[model samples]
Target: MNKCIFFFLSLYLLCFQSFAQTSSVKTVPNADLVYEKTKLGEQVNSPYYEGQPVVSADGKFLFVYRVGHPDNVGYKTYKKDEDIWVGERMADGSFSTMRNVGAPLNTATNNAVLGISGDGNTLFLYDQYNLSADYAVTNIAVSERTTDGWGKPQSIKIKGFRWVSEPAYMNMSVDKRILLISYANNRVTFGKQDLYVSFLEADGTFSEPLNLGKDINTAGIEASPFLAADNVTLYFSTDGRAGYGNLDVFVTKRLDDTWQKWSEPLNLGAKVNTPFWDCEFSMTAKGDVAYFTSGGQNYGENADVYQVKIKEVARPEPVAMIYGKVLNKNTNEPIATKISYTNIKTHQNAGLASSNPKDGTYKIYLPKDKAYSFFAEKDGFFAIKENIDLTGLKTYTEIERNIYLVPIETGVAIELSHLYFMQSQPTLLPSSEDELEQLFDILQKYPTMQIEIAGHTDGVGNKQKNQMLSVQRANAVKDYLVKKGITAERIKTVGYGGSRPIASNEKEETRKLNRRVEFKVLSK
Candidate 1:
């Protein structure tokens, strides 16, 4: 048995156990589980140069940047501007022939794909779009995947971010909350290129870059940082750590919420590392297979992208996949919208995804052992948050949950999806924060809107006491909104004790559905 040391099982998720307890964990790499590496061959690797490998979150797309290759934008036989190439993963585990990603992405200047969003709807590009025909300063840019190829790349603003000559690499977190970058920011950089982190701000811009500190960065160079789906496990290449090569790939676990502390860096061993240069490790949600670049693997002193199967212990922390469609409740039709999720206990922005415009489907990967509140939003739709508990999850899973958004209008009684109360009391539980905050937001957006709060209980409860308890719970919610500055006159409350059971009351599973809080628009 794997001697898993989950330090804070005694702590509750409500307390945010990951950071609330010990700042230590053990995820030993199983040497037997690592397979031999295979080069990508002529399609990706060429005589000129091939390096800086990046794989999409879904593992469907693999992109690499090349230098001096004839297939480049300028087709330079000598040293020239870089160009990005893309390949799709075939069913048989082979990648298709690399095709030059032309136009806006590949110019007379260097270009690369640093990261891709979890939903595969967004791409994190190498540099800004507005530039002279000559090479310009490099900075990260973003582009959305549209029906018409990709949308125009937009350069994002990062406070105090500047670059001149040194190379840089970055990876956007799976939830898009954090950006892990390897760059030489002279201000905080301990030495040459050091690993740093930037947080996603409320306005969609990135905060000022903060060096990941001495534990992970050194006076040497750190390149190609890849933040795994778990957000805690980080894989990067560095000459700072003792390894098999000049620059070897290493895995490190983040000790706490602070981007500073880290576990001792572990080299990937000779199986994945060599006496030359080995780096750029990327994987999908499953974390079973890895795609990286190994220099001089096929051609002498030339870099090539390679793939290998890694065992569970060496992979990133396991995560579960949630996928489904956002549909209309009344008409049962597909709806194209943005889906958002939040951590109920911590009340933090967890992740984001987009439903396909044509099919209304969305996919998101989340870490196990936590609770989440997720939903889709539209102007006329009430963005009710549905809950999911992965606290007991033990393996990778694909959970399909179709969200149905109900129209917001007069007399539309929409039950609060994830709202809950303390056992038999009227106190609102912490998990109710997401739904209530959403309700508050909708009310604020539409200033003149009025709503009624109704509470219900299962039929097994005492009639009079149940009615009193239900009313108290409804009042509790009303008080919450009122304290938040909403006018009391615009809100009303009622309780239906065991009268409107939505499901069978005999079993606790279905009976819980009957005990719920709902809201109806009194006026709009």
Candidate 2:
């Protein structure tokens, strides 16, 4: 009778704890639940003790905090409050032998599983904080893994907020410009706890904390927020709504350009949640497998880590490519120069690369759907900056761009022909602006071209004075080109004090024709 009762209880627990292997939701028809838990073995026994699992952006490896002793420790000193182990799961679903990540990643001190970085190199853990057990400080620490092993654990201090029990999670935006961190604010414990986000600077420093506001945050406790690789979708744990128990995992997606217009949170449903604590859930970039913490039923003691198949959802893919070129202005010659791309929205630097001198072309791979700023620079030329606001265009789109460089000459004589300026005024006429606009457009279309901006005079006034005026007039033309988004470095201006004339300066009509500004394509 006793054996039968034990058997019945075991079966009931197994049936209730079983992970769903498939999802009928077609939001992500192409993706299926790819990883699942197995019975722990000597290495990783059945119903493997797993929790706080994080997969790489490519779904290649898994990082998790596991606890157990396989090396015959006599079970006496192998207490449940022992060391936290870090395990790596390979593509074959076989986890590398659970290795103590060691101090500072895993200290002799008790640590709670927190979060993992997008690159899978950084890990966040907090000191155990159960007041009843005498562990009550909210100690937060982060460890970075070098090529060798994990580095020393460094603690992060949050100002004005005490009891920083939960370090929450951090991730990249769709464009990878900004780093979003979600943490439970114990600042006001009585009111529902709040979640805050802080930006990561180019130098790896975090900016001032910004409250996510009351929209996504509620007066109820909110914690364990995980940012999807796309950066726009956020998953967090809250007790505001009904679940299997006290806390359930809910997700909120960034809705509009407005920072606060987040969509309402959606419950992950009953199967994944139990009438017990289910929080700190995490998902990979592929949105396939999910990991969380649970204590009741099958899990031996305390909060043990749990894994299950998440319904494949339509999440954004942040990997993509962008390409273009740089060139000379005068002869349309391709100039080999350096160019840099920056993700303004996410604050990510794509690094600097050179355009091919032979063909004046370049290509850059972007993590799709991120806005960027492209800047090109060369000696003796004005730097050019182009702002690309790729709000939602993350597909494999090919962008073709070019740049022009001006000459170094002081002055060159040229016939205006029909190049008419506002009579005697340096202001270019509407028709003249149109002509220059067309030339600028061509330069943009073909990035390897170079050109010279020349000014001429009809010798009607003081030669010296006319020369200076013509120079100014040519500079005005250059400024106009700059306003049209052309690189000023690609436009060299010079005035010929009526020194050289294509048309005879004998008649007012000929002199009128002599006074003008013209561009010559030096290379194509």
Best by TM-score: 1
Candidate 1 matches the true fold with a TM-score of: 0.87
Task: Name the regions of candidate 1 deviating beyond 4 angstroms.
Answer: 1-35, 46-48, 68-79, 132-138, 296-301
Whole-model lDDT for model 1 versus the true structure?
0.79
Model 2 Cα shift for residue 366 (angstroms): 6.2
Q: Who wins the lDDT comparison?
A: 1
Using all chains and alpha carbons, the TM-scores for the candidates as numbered come to 0.87, 0.51
Deviation from truth (RMSD, Å), model 2: 12.7
Task: Tell me the tens digit of each residue's lDDT in model 2 across 1-524.
Answer: 99999999999876665432112211212322423422223333323454555555434444555555442122245543344564567667656666655555544344444555433445555643222354545334666555466666676543343443433554333232344445555453323566666554555444555667666677576766777655577877766654445666677777765456787776666555556666666665556566677654332234656666644344434433345557656677777666666665554465444555456565543545556666556654443445566667544344566655454333432223334566656777654433454456766865666677778777777888888878877887788878988877776777776886768878877666677677666655
Model 1 scores worst on lDDT over the 10 consecutive residues at 19-28
lDDT of 1 at 144: 74
List model 1 lDDT by residue over 503-523, tens digit each: 998899999889989999999
